[model samples]
Target: MSEHDKPGRIAPYPRPAGGWDAIKFSAASLRQEKVVLGNLKAFLKQNQPHGFDCPGCAWPERRHTNRLEFCENGVKAVAAEITSKLVTANFFARHTVTELMRQSDLELEQHGRLAVPLRYDPTSDTYRPIEWDQAFALIAEQLHALDSPNQASFYASGRTSNEAAYLFQLFARLYGTNNFPDCSNMCHEATSRGLPGTVGIGKGTVTLEDFELADAILIFGQNPGTNHPRMLGELRDAARRGATIVSINPLRERGLERFSSPQHAAEVLAGGSTELCSLFIRPSLGGDFALIKAMAKRVVELDDAACATGGERVLDVAFIETHTVGIDEFLADLRQESWSLLIEESGVPREEIERLTQLFVRARSVIATWGMGITQHRRSVPTIQLLSNLMMLRGQIGRPGAGLCPVRGHSNVQGNRTVGIEERPTAAFLDRLAAVYGFEPPREHGLDVVATIQAMLAGSVKVFFGLGGNFVMAAPDTPRTFEAMRRCALTVQVATKLNRSHLVHGQQALLLPTLGRSEIDLQEGIEQSVTVEDSMSMVHLSRGFKPPASDQLLSEVAIIARLAEAVVGNRLVDWRALATDNSLIRNHIAQVFEAFTDYNRRVAAPGGFHLGVASRDRVWKTASGKAQFVVHPLDLDTPIHRARRQYGDQAMVLMTTRSHDQYNTTIYALDDRYRGVYGQRDVVFANRRDIDRLGCRPGDRVDLSTIWDDGIERRLNGLLLVEYDIPLGCLAAYFPEANPLVPLDSVGDESNTPTAKSIPVRMLPHLD
Candidate 1:
């Protein structure tokens, strides 16, 4: 097929109110198919109970209040799970791995859930059914055959429960390697690494209840409306209460602009979308660091003004003096930063910056929330630290209405990290783990996702095992990631459905089908419930209601247990017992980590419990027992220039994003309703002048190539252009499809998060 003929290659943006149309469009799509309302009804009721949490977003539930707790995307998530489609051995027999690879990610997922354990036979290029025991034995043999434990890398998805993740990490460590690379490396590694230096903990310090009391909410780099629909209700409620909600993002996201909560009966019937952001500040792509630094400078200025007037110190003098260090140095660095640099870098006018600063100064309490946008940049870690520093200056931490909120993507992503899923495990944590498990844990830091892929390409890594994730597609530089997976001696995936990662077959691969969170988990003739931690540090239990789609499907814990037994035969830990009883798993966790003391008992309560954020009590965990301010000398090596260069004409920096109808890599439909895009996912939204400058018209074919070190290139033959209210020198496109263009080597300086938000790309006429 020609490039132009491909779906998503060339399509026009839909008219405004496309979201309203999408509600109809999706309904039509569902009407044509058999609806499984029974499954959905039962599944939603089991949410936030003694079961596994929803694998979609990290938005907290409202204390299990209503019968209908599912959001719009949550509906899509559960519908995708309860999908009538199935990919059995027969389906695999019909299509070769190569043939499946040619299909789109949507088409791959549409093939449906894997009904049984399947092993890839390279000779036939098809996956064949394999017994669970045989699958475990094969994986054990391949891992054991590796020259060293470092040659094996363990990848995890955010979907895995805390118990399952704990066991997976324990098993990997017991096998003698810290090569644990996870999804966090690709998304929020900056927050995970940077927040600890600013606050006492790596996770968010606020609870869901804090939103109700917050006087001001500053949302940075997050589009909660689509990515996290449930958050809209909270934001809407906060807005209704007259709290100032400021949105800081490069794009004017509809979610941040306005949201009509489907849950709100009055608004839903009246067709009214509540106004969300009181002030929407659009910063340039990769300009978050500069903008935050400017905000901190403003705070310093405000502090000086208040001191000169003999008024109350606006800089939280008490908090800083007691719990922080290096403020003087940070102030010096802020004063030295030129206004011209801040204006040029942030893409926001000086007047607008002053206006935002004034609002911050006026607010008595503030809550700062951020997402991947801030984390996927060159100075991601420092940017996060700066935000934390700003919050500290305002005395935001430890209060009911003020704190730091890092909007985590997955339901259990935070939980996984909380329970021994770190690439760099501290000596203290390892010692505790050793004391609990009765074995010396490896002291070496493990490889992250990017490092693991690089090691695999370098042939230093051999076996690859994913607890739950589409690592090949989710990772940056798809071609390289896929090649690395194929080069592995053995690949094992524990998943619920068929995805692009499954098609990227290894020399020998095994697909261990696992039960989804919505499905019932029966073990040893008893029902089981899994636990997950939210982004706000609230731990809750999740109980499944609907029966398992496949009788052969096993819970994640069961799969891990079987693998551990096969690999570590007669090991110190009782893997089988832990799998059969999650309480025992919690007991082991409590023994290892102090934070999880009385884990089993505490989790049995209604909403579980709070993990306790030490920073909330004004405790700083830095070297001097106080929050230390670190200064970064700005690198002027690569300045933003619009002139034609060796790479290409100085085009806009394109930040790939997910459409309203999509989540992460999952494409439910080909429509970004909020952006007025419909029946297509390949169209690029750009300012009208950009198209004219390139001598291209709407629906013109174009190729986008990144000028990054890792030779990764992506071209979309024809994309329908749309004139939008976007800032100059900026472009927006859909993700996962555009993920291939983001090079593996182009990562944040300190956090190593793939720079998915800031890629310098050039646009050109499509070659016939």
Candidate 2:
């Protein structure tokens, strides 16, 4: 029996990625879904040309995908979505909203896909079934009642299709509000903000095929085991082909350690796996800036040595002088960043830094990728700029097998941003959009995720409209966010399943049920296929095969189009026509976004077409008309220093993490299989030394309090401590649950992204 079967014992999980355990888990999920042989066939079609896309992650599919084109997590996500479960209005009538809110987030969503539109009646304390027309009318009434257009905030989730996102943004702009707060604002806003200054584009320059040619790949702050299991196959293949894979993270991840591919029969039969990750470096939380700077320093010094002693220099001086600017100023900044300070902050030895530099120097081509771990910090923008500077020195931006790759977490997140889900839209983009749609788009910038919460708290925002997400649970300062949301006059969620966001409602709230990715979407008389972009900017068509769960369910496109029609009907464009046909929306998208030219014609291709990023061809769209060597100063007050000065000597930097069985705020199970955590979510992972120093034992319950000058006490209670491999002066807990401890004011510099991974906190004995 698993540790979940027991009450208190926290089991320690061993073994690497894709073992027999993965197979068993996949089988268990299928069994739970009550899948048949036909369902198995449908599962195999995922990520293919004719089938639906995997709703789990944004990892790019191969040009020619495999027959079994999904990972274990992909299977779990599909199974979860296409489950044979029902949570009818009668069920809600039996259980009050107050009583439902008391259940876990997992339990709330596990109530299953909503079959019809619902309206929360506070007097009854339960959701009542409502007509779609009535729901739209109610929303339109509330929206028009708002004093100003700016009083409303529109949110878009990453799961939204490109067509739906385009129409949704168009509708919002036509309705007169640029207050577009999206999922990207919370996670990768730093990458979307920082990289454009140097690379001319916010997206990654490398393609999926580039991984095959990479001599050395540097992965920073991402774990592929639980978060992105599909990436493990690529890493495993790279390792088998003798490529060097380097990992820099706080914890030792099993995905980078070894992987047993379920595809390989020999490996499965022999119980063997391929070893990945040539080098693993553990840096202190928020220490990536110093660590990367030290590596850059070593590279510059080595180049000087080679030039002075008569040898080929490490840096591509041609590329630097011709393709880049401010190299001299950048080197000056590196020289001032002392090795002693770097070693002290980075917690990486001088020898390791030198070794990392040597690997860079020897590599013919390199690809440096990062995830939320590097982005969810106070200095995230500067840190990413430093990474860009490192890439510039080696001439990696425009070369084959070399460039920066900011791996997107959600299915169509990058696509949504591409199709105009940005708060800060360029004048050129707006001008083109206006030319196509004949409406003056909002010139004023809009509120992001954090700013939206602040607006709601100040009572400046009256309406909260979400396309698909649990904003209250996914955001920082959960208690504050929950209260802020309650201040809204109206809250609307266009979702497929029930979640905590539905419970933390405004005075009036509506739940608009939509079709899932696994279900068929029939707009008029014809079935429609949606397009989504992957991490590498590859857009492909996804057509669902399964029947709709309920006849009352509508597609996201239909809902957005209907909402637009009800609010602002056909003034700018024919909203009713766009609802019936998604191709028209795609044409509108093509006219607005330049890269998506020939949208309808090209998207019909076998693997779909690349947006063809100009940065990939050595084109730098910066103000200087070339790639830039942006300088980032190393000396600053990190989170740890601020915590010590404000809270006490015992304050530690806390990081919000996700469980193995979770996707964003949606919890699939209460257990985190890889971490050996089971049947519980109220647990914190800490170093054994830190636990002892805190006068706490393994499994000892504790309370966490945040350290900040917000003049408010942010605390989380009833957390059990678990000893694990991590840096000292750091604590790890799952997000949404731990979001309460992160202050709303604690945001990344210039990026405005929440510093969820680097909040300072102190652990106290649980009195309860």
TM-score result, candidate 1: 0.95
TM-score of each: 0.95, 0.98
- Top candidate (lDDT): 2
Candidate 2 deviant stretches above 4 angstroms: 1-7, 646-649
lDDT of 2 by residue, 466-561 (tens): 999889999999989999999999999988888889889899999888988888887667878899998888999988888888899999999999
Q: Tens digits of per-residue lDDT for model 1 on 449-525?
A: 99999998999999999988888878888878888888888888889888888888678999989998888888888
Q: Determine which window of 10 residues in candidate 1 has minimal summed lDDT.
A: 10-19
Among all windows of ten consecutive residues in candidate 2, which has the lowest summed lDDT? 1-10
lDDT of 2 at 498: 86
Top model number, TM-score? 2
Q: For candidate 2, give the lDDT of residue 447.
A: 93
